[model samples]
Target: MSAPFVKEIPTLLSLIQCADSLVKNPLTKESPFSVRVAWFDDAAKTQTALLTHYPRLVKESFYTEFEDTVQAGISLLNFQPFWSIMLGVETSQSSAAAESSATMPDSSPIVIPSVAGKDSPPEKSAIR
Candidate 1:
């Protein structure tokens, strides 16, 4: 009997992890600011292409353009989750900073206007 064929799709988490690494360490051992990130369901396919094209693509200019293209593609993808995670990180960091502060405001007041005041002359602070 023939084996059933399977098709694989890379997970969004894997892509996000790779992007995180690129955003963190955007450098390769051989060159600075030179990183190439590509994904395929079949690693062999990617390996074959890399083996065939690595030499031709090993150059500063090539990496510069490659980086730009890769970054552009990453930018095109929905990175809202990544952005939200980053915002959470910032919020935590700020929370820590706020905790360190000697005085933190408990609450702030809100102003409201009444219908009676709406018909009256405007106050100096209410000038629009």
Candidate 2:
């Protein structure tokens, strides 16, 4: 959301790499590690996007605990329209498995703050 925050992407990636290394055992080939992320694109008309393809070699990782937490909070405040981004580690068989598992059900209801601004407009339509 801010310039300073955007600059921390590299650092976040490093932390995620470290976490992945800690979670994945070098001796166990079955327990490979990877990072999965979801992001919102204004043009897409969808709230999120996930990694659909795997690169020949995956090298970089991105960790965003604070960012994700903040986004989760914002989503709650904004009536859960969607989150800006979400980051998580995957130790599954493949990226597809990770993507499937990361998706949230549409029926879930997210709670928002009870207080509304005095100047805020009245609700014209009920939230489905």
Candidate 3:
């Protein structure tokens, strides 16, 4: 028998794109947040890099309150304004297929992250 062939999952870049879209523009009424995932052979290094790269975010109330950083990351991604800079894009969209299947969705999920220097209350306050 011949060796089986398997297709590769989309690249991190593609994943980021997908995440950016969902974060940028939510579709369903209940599910609004987006997600980003990173894979690595070395889990420790990946965790280190994430913490090091976003120390402020990691230190903020939102991150501190959450038990899992992965969930924190997902929450952060939902923060509307900040998500834009992470991807350097105007707006984003979630995958239609994924949105349809989701359950236990977030109510009033973040649509636009608060912009810096704006009158909006800081996101940090939301956590408290």
Please tell me which predicted candidate would have the highest lDDT against the true structure: 1
Q: Which candidate is the best by TM-score?
A: 1
**TM-score of each candidate structure, all chains considered together:** 0.23, 0.18, 0.21
Q: List the residue pairs that clash in candidate 3.
A: 21-92, 21-93, 22-93, 80-112, 80-113, 81-113
**In what order do the candidates fall by TM-score, top score first?**
1, 3, 2
| Candidate 2 lDDT over residue span 42-69, tens digit each | 2111111212232211232222332343
Count of backbone clashes, every candidate in sequence: 0, 0, 6
Instruction: Output the better candidate (1/2) by lDDT.
Output: 1
Candidate scoring better on TM-score of 1 and 3: 1
lDDT of 3 by residue, 1-128 (tens): 11111011223333334433433442332543331222111222323333433344455443443324433444644643443343332111222223342542434432323345677565644322
lDDT agreement with native, every candidate? 0.36, 0.31, 0.34
Task: Predict model 2's lDDT versus the native.
Answer: 0.31
> RMSDs, each prediction?
23.6, 19.3, 19.3
Estimate the TM-score for candidate 2: 0.18
Q: What is the lDDT of residue 8 in candidate 2?
A: 23
Q: Give lDDT: candidate 3, residue 120.
A: 54
